[model samples]
Target: MATYIIGDIHGCYDELQSLLTQAQFNQNTDELWFTGDLITRGPKSLETLRFIKGLGDTAKIVLGNHDLHLLSINEGIFPNHKKDNLTPIFEAPDCNTLLTWLRFQPLMRRHPAFKFALVHAGVYPRWSLKKAEKLAKEIEVQLQSENYKQLLIDMYGGAPCSWSNNLTGIKRMRFIINAFTRMRYCLPDGSLDFKNKLSPEQTNNANLTPWYEAITLKPNRSILFGHWASLMGKVNKSNIYGLDTGCVWGNSLTMLRWEDKKYFSVPSTIK
Candidate 1:
C-alpha cells in the first residue's frame, strides 16, 4: 500500500486524473493526500470537488486559501470575483453536501505512523509541532461548529502579522488561517508577508524570506505543503516539500510518493 501527496489542484480535474494514472494510484490500496486549492480558477471546480469527495476514506485534504475563499463565497460571506470559475460548484445539485464536507475538513493533518505532517501552507516559525497541532485543532473546531458562518465572515484579511500569545477571538483565528493557507514570505522575525509572490531568488526585498527558510522546526519533524506555486516545488531543503507546480496556471500537476520519495507529474490541459 502506497501513499501519495499531491500539490494544489486548482480546478484542473483532467490533470489530476492524469497525474493519478501516472502515479499508478490504486484507489483500493493506496491513499491520496491533497494540499488543497481543490477548486477555483480553472474549468472543473465541481468535477474536482465531486471526484475527491467520492474518494471517501482514500483521500485526505488540508484546506488552502482558495478553498476557504470558495467556502466564503458559497456561504455568501464573500463575493465571487470576475476571474473566478466556481459557479459550477455553487450550481451543482450536491453543492450543499460538498461544501459541508469541505467545511469539516481540517487545516492540518499528521500521519499516525509517519514522521511528517501535512498542511496547506507552512507552519509558524515560532510554533512547535505540539503547539501547531493544538492551534490548528482550535480553528478546525470553530469551522465545524454552529458558529462557522460567523467564523467564515471574519476569516478574511492579513492582519496581526506576527503571532502573539495575547491575541484572542477572530484576530487569532484569522492569523492561524492565514499562516496555514495563504502565507508565503515572512520577515526575519516570523511576521508573515502577504504581498510577495516572487520566489526566494527573484524577490528584490532583502528583509523578506520564504516561510520555510525562517522555520525552526524540531528534529524528526517534516512538512508537506502547497500554497505558493511560485516556488515551483522548490524549497532547497530535504524536510520541507513544496508540491504546488501551478497546474491551473498551465504548469504541471506534481505529486510525491511518501514511502519511496518518487515524483510524478502531468502537464496541464489548460492553456
Candidate 2:
C-alpha cells in the first residue's frame, strides 16, 4: 500500500485526477494525505469537495485557510473576501455537505510510523509537535460543538500576535487557527506577521523570518505543508516539505510519495 501526500488542491479537480493518474494511485491499496485548501479559487469546488469526501478513510485532510473561509461564509460568520471567486461552490446543491466535511477536518495530524507531521499551513516556531497536537484538538472540540458558529464568527483578526498561556475565549481560538491555517512569515520574537505574502527574499522587512526558519523544536522530525505557493515546489531542508505548487494559479499540482520520497506532478488546467 502506497501513501501519497498531495499539495493544496484549491478545487482544481481535473489536475488532481491527473496527478493521481501520474502517481498510479490505487484507491483500494493506497492512502492519500491532502495538505488542504480542498476548495475555492478554481472552477469546480463542488466536484473537488465531493471527490475527496467520497474517499472516506482512504484519505486524510487537514483544514486550510480557504476551507475555513468557506465554512465561515456558509455559517454567515465572515462575508466572502471581495477578491474571492467562490460562487460555484456557494451555489452548488451539495454545498452543505461540502462545508460539513470541511469543518470536520483537523488542523493538524502526526503519523509516528512515518515520523512526519501534516498540517495545512505550518506549525508555529514556538510550539513543539506535542503542543501543536494538543492545541489542534482544543479547536477541534469547539468546531464540533454547538458554539461552533459563534467561534467561527470570532475566528478572524491578527491580534494577540505572540502566544501567551493567559489568552482565553475567542482571542485564543483565533490565534490558534491563524497559526495553524494562515501562518507564513513571523517576527523574530515568534509573533505572526500576516501582512507579507511575498517570497522571503523579495521582502524588505528585516525583522521577519519564515516559520520554518524560526522553528526550534523536534529538529529530527519532518513537516509537510502547503499555503505558501510562492515557494513553488521547494523542500527547503531535508526535514521540511513545502508542497503548494500553485495549482490554483495555473501551475502544476504536486504529490510526494512518503515511503520512497518520490514526487509526481501534473500541470493544472487553470489559466
Candidate 3:
C-alpha cells in the first residue's frame, strides 16, 4: 500500500480530485497524509471538508492556520474576512462533525518507520523532533478542550518571538501556533518575520533564514511541510520536502509518494 503526502488543499476540491486521479490513489489500501489548510480561499470549502471527512481512517490531516481561523470564526472569536467565503461550510448540515474532526487533528506528526516529520508549516529549527511533538500536543490539548473557544479568542497577536521555558498561557500558545503554521522567514535570533512572504532571496533581509536553513536536522530524517507557496514546490535540502504549489493562487497542486519519492501534480483551475 502506498502512502501519499499531499500539500495544502486550501479548498480546491476539484484540483485535489484531479491530483488523486493522476496519482491513481487507491482508497482502500493507500493512505493520504495532508499537510493541512484544508479549507478557505478557494471556491469549494464545504465539498473539500466533506470529501476528506469521508476518507475516515484512510486520511491523516494536520491543522493549518486557515483551519484554525475557521474554528475561531465559527466560535465568534474572530471576524470572518470578506475574502474567506466560508459561509457554506458554516451552514452545512455536517458542520459540527467536520469541525469536531478538524479540532481534534494534531498539529505535528512523526512517522518513525519513515523517519519523517509532517507539519502544516515547519518546526522551529532549534526544536528536536520529540520537543516539537511535545510542544504541539500542548496546544492540541487546548484546541480539543471545552475552553477551546476561549483559547481561540486569545490566539491572535504576536510576541515572545523566541522560545522561552518560562512562557505560559496564550503567549506560549501563539508562539507554538505561529511556528507550526504561519512561519516562513525568521531572524537569526528567532524572531518571526511575519511580513516577509516573498521568496527567501527576494526579502532583502540578510539576518533572516528559512526555518529549514536555520539548523541542521538529522541527516537520516526528513521534514515534509506546506504553507509557503512562494517556494513554488521546492524541496530545498534533501531532508526537507515543501509541497505547497499555490493552488489557491492559480498554481498547481502537488503530492509526493513517500516510499518511492515520486511526485505528482495537477494544474489549477482557479485562474
lDDT of 3: 0.90
Error of 3 at 237 (Å): 0.6
TM-score of each: 0.98, 0.95, 0.97
Report model 2's TM-score to 2 decimal places: 0.95
Candidate 3 structure quality by residue, lDDT tens digits, 1-271: 9999999999999999999999899999999999999999899999999999899989988999999999999988878886887989888888898899999999999876898999998988878988999999999999999989988888787676788878898889989998999988779777787777888756777888988888578888889999999988675698899999999999999999998999999999999
lDDT string for model 2 (147-214, tens) is 88988888888987889878898888989999999999888777998888887767788998889888
Give the candidate number with the greatest lDDT.
1
- Regions more than 4 Å wrong, model 1: none
What ranking of all candidate models by lDDT puts the best one first? 1, 3, 2
Error of 2 at 167 (Å): 1.2
The local lDDT score (0 to 100) that residue 209 gets in candidate 3 is 90
Q: With candidate 3 superimposed using the best TM-score fit, by how many Å does residue 44's alpha carbon deviate from the native? A: 0.7
Candidate 1 displacement at residue 41 in angstroms? 0.7
Q: Worst 10-residue stretch by lDDT in candidate 3?
A: 194-203
Model 3 TM-score, all chains together: 0.97
Q: Please provide, for model 1 over 182-265, each residue's C-alpha lDDT reduced to its tens digit, 9 standing for 90 to 100.
A: 889889777989988888879989999887887876677789999888889989987999999999899899999999999999
- Give the range where candidate 1 is weakest over 10 consecutive residues by summed lDDT: 213-222
